[model samples]
Target: MKRPVPRIDLFDVRPDDERAFVFAQDLRIIEARLFSSAEPQTSTTLRPHLSAKADVGALMEALQRDYAPRGVNLLRVAGGWMLCTAPDLAPVLNEQAPEQRKLSRAAVEVLAIIAYHQPVTRAEIEDIRGVSTSKGTLDVLLETGWIRLRGRRRTPGRPVTYGTTPAFLVQFGLDSVQDLPGLDELKGAGLLDGRIPAGFSIPLPSDDPQLHEDEEPVEPEPLDFTLSPLPTADEDEN
Candidate 1:
């Protein structure tokens, strides 16, 4: 359901450099909380006050126009302003954090396609992957809020199309699809193969035997084919 944008105290942004990033991150946390809220309150410090009376437009200008030039990227979504680094610099952080776990090749490709040609259909995805995706695969991404439906495509059947979610960018430390690694970069890094790193398959644990001990055994049906003639109407009735 659509809700009112909580008034954020725009003036709360501290006058500092490194703290800008912290404030930017904190601003998103506040927005996420506000977006998910029902009875939005004004008592919240960061909801929507700015410079003792500056309007939101002026605040955005101050944040996105001026501060962003100094290396911040302010994005307005869901009636809230979020502070983050420009998409241009996202790769630098990812490069620096080499220890961060990489997603499976299949998952990465799925994400990449969604990032590039968003609102794409499952058929299109299968064509791109050259293999049918498990039904649960997309479910996993959706459950993690990495992707979401972007309405249906106006095709023959109007299948629901998929697109990346904001959480996806946050998780990857990216500002947008524009921050995605270039084709040449992926190729140079030998990542085109899209192989998942070793041993990520999580095998399920066995259920408790106690739960099934009293359950009925499923009997395997015996084959009864002996070149029998098709049942006549009389025999069928009998």
Candidate 2:
């Protein structure tokens, strides 16, 4: 029997609707990985970025409204809004996101200190960590969405202060630091050990006299962001 004539595969560069749709999904996931690798943007960073961009805009808007009452914030980034935690809780979110990325323990600690102690200088984070932070560590965190430069402190040498972004909150899935797990859970720091250190004096929201305890504090309720209505695909900027 003669073999069937070989046919060349068609070279159709134009994507069909289904191919385009699946391709779009693949792109989104790739973008997520890229963004995640960039820096510590947020703890619960993945879903929020996905929802707020491109196709799912409308769904995101609805989610914000649903999650807002629980103290979630659907923040509009300079480019567009993404779900973020309340400003005050930046430090806690960073702390909770340890090991989620390639960050070193020292780097995560520094990021937390900056988020909580914003407008603070490198000297300050070192004081808290009881170790000097490498510039690359801060650079990594900055590249990620977790922290940013606030401004120079009004002091001699005018050291730069760092702060957390709305993106940071989103990545960490926190509404506010007040919602951070109680002292019991933090001390149970499986990866890192001990309390905020003996001499560190960052202001805390706890009423308990002993803010730092032997055991880790109980973990707070995970952030519950209420989604909000956003533009439809027709109105999407992308």
Candidate 3:
């Protein structure tokens, strides 16, 4: 009888096939890393486990393409990569999930102001809103992990400034603050009516993650405690 043919393994493949095989394994590792992570993973974090010849960018692109037709998609958010449910499937999933607590209208307005004009003080927020911001509203936002105390304003009293956090970007599916809708886009969405106001313009937000000239780094330990709680006109407003 003729000798049985030997089994073909990935190691026995041609040069191109061998690289492809290695890449497939790398893709598996990437998928696992993404699935197991509670937060988005950056290329810097994912590069270590990959093969020496594997290109993280190329692998990510390939993986993105592979998932394009599936229920999940590879998205770049908060300066990193994550696999998330396809946008079209969100409604169905939302229905299945338990009802989630929603931000109050006042909280929503405060969040929007911070997102657009970050490194802003409570007074500045009140200035923009034309009303005293309630402490409860800020407390609620802080408890949600959507915003953080960035730094202290250089002006007298050195009030603590607030800005949106990375969680904010992840929740909103934005790659960066700059991805926020522009004035025209907002108007087109009917968010901004055709109200006539001369010299009206929306400020372009930044994601510098650095203290501004008018701001100072938040000191740790006892210094942080020295800043008293912000004065609120209302004890509670939801």
Candidate 4:
């Protein structure tokens, strides 16, 4: 008779150890998903890639714990999960300036106004800024993917309205538009004067993508907005 194969019990493993191994595998899957994605990943989007019985929440928590001491961290951003370098490491990494188109001051102001007051018309933006807003400025912002044409206002001209995009939230590392600095925080940051009118206040920003009661959906083939070439660095307005 052939030498009896060495008897081995495959089921002799401890239940806790087996569970731990499964947990570690699931954590790796979650980690890989986060690493491979260019944008933040929501649990719903990540569920299909994991084992049927995997607990995504627990796995994410465990992965977060594992990375707590690392140079990078798993953080929530733009209503999803993303791996970001720890804040403390920013100074060390700031020397390498990434090449990117710089936004003009006008574009920055327009962007801020859109973030604070969404579904606003071009006229409304100009009114709030107390100056004319150039189509070129709006075009620069649109090209940045930070703002979008939300809809058309129901008023006389039925002008197109603007709102912040999810890209804006991600760029700013915010979970929502409401996470933007409030009046108190602005004052603390010296972005506002200490002496302000009692009635002056910041508008509560909303990123809701729905058309408001006074707004209508944009046409399927909306009219193309005419955009002028962006100004060169030296020509950009202060």
lDDT of each: 0.56, 0.55, 0.87, 0.84
Rank all candidate structures by their lDDT, best first, as comma-separated numbers: 3, 4, 1, 2
lDDT of 2 by residue, 167-213 (tens): 66556655554444544555576644654567644455221222122
* Best model number under lDDT: 3
TM-scores vs. true structure, each candidate: 0.44, 0.42, 0.84, 0.82
Candidates 1 and 4 compared by TM-score, better number: 4
Q: On residues 34-102, what C-alpha lDDT tens digit does candidate 4 reach at each position?
A: 899889898898888777777776776666777789999998888888998888899988889586888
Which portions of model 2 show Cα errors greater than 4 Å? 1-101, 188-202, 205-238
Worst 10 residues of 2 by lDDT: 206-215
Residue 92 error, candidate 3, Å: 1.7
What ranking of all candidate models by TM-score puts the best one first? 3, 4, 1, 2
Scored against the true structure, residue 92 in model 2 reaches a CA lDDT of 68
Q: Who wins the TM-score comparison?
A: 3
Deviation (Å) of 211 in candidate 3: 0.9
Candidate 1 similarity to native, TM-score:
0.44
lDDT of 3 by residue, 130-217 (tens): 9999989999999999999999999999899999999999999999999999899999999998993788878898758899999998
Between candidates 2 and 4, which one is better according to TM-score?
A: 4
Error of 4 at 222 (Å): 7.9
RMSD of 3: 11.5
